[model samples]
Target: MTSLSKGDKAPEFHGLNQNNETISLETFKGKKIILYFYPKDNTPGCTAESCNLNDNYQAWLAKGYEVVGVSPDSVASHKKFADKFQFGFNLIADTEKEILQAYGVWGEKSMYGKKYMGVMRTTFVINESGIIEDIFEKVDTKNHTDQIIKALDIK
Candidate 1:
């Protein structure tokens, strides 16, 4: 798997959003993108990060950017998570894990010495030109969306 990093052309794919509508990076061409890959939906830290972004969504819009959350979850689960948390952005249902793997966020993770494979909780910031400008390989779930906005200076 090619490690997604700064200067890499953001891997593009067409997938279903929370509503089961198909979308791709091509759809958001000419705009900055926040492609956040978390482990799951409706979980404690994931929900908080998503909700934080939703709370500060207008600021992000004013700065002209789009947020897309991806995980191995299904569309139905994403819909429920979005509805429950009023997530204003698109939650991608990457059931095949293609997107996650493409971004190199799917790998072995160990928790308490029990090694297991799972989503690596990573985030990528693709610029309007479709170049990956920033990559947060290990993200702090608490208030992490703010970190993205700050790192990108989305004022």
Candidate 2:
């Protein structure tokens, strides 16, 4: 799997959000971006991670940051997930896997010794200029917001 690192340019991506509205990297330009890739919608780990971000979303916004979650789910699924959880940010539907592959989060993963290609739980901290500031390959689902806050050294 190709790994993106700090100082690298975040890949440009555009897709439909939970509301079926077009969202792209350009939409978040000039703002710090929390671009997280999850395995699926409504899953246990994913739910926890999303809720944590939701809980701390206002703080992020106040600091000029925006949180966006990406997965290969459909727009309808994303809508339901957001509505159920009251997520404060956008959930991008990467149904074509283009954004996932571009970010290098789509790769081989093993579950119970069965290896397969799927989305990896990853988060990218991108600066206002679209340069990657940090990469979280091993995300702590339960405390993901804390992880980001710590990584970015947000006060």
Best by lDDT: 2
Over the stretch 1-155, how does candidate 1's per-residue lDDT look in tens digits?
A: 23876899999877999999998999999998888888899899888878887887777778887888999999999999999988899999999999888888889888899999899888888889999999987676777767886777755
**Candidate 1, clashing residue pairs?**
none
lDDT of each: 0.86, 0.94
- Identify the candidate with maximal TM-score: 2
Residue 43 error, candidate 2, Å: 0.7
lDDT, residue 80, model 2: 99
Local error of candidate 2 at residue 148 (angstroms): 1.3
Positional deviation of residue 132's Cα in model 2 after best superposition, in angstroms: 0.2
The worst-scoring run of ten residues by lDDT in candidate 1 lies at 146-155
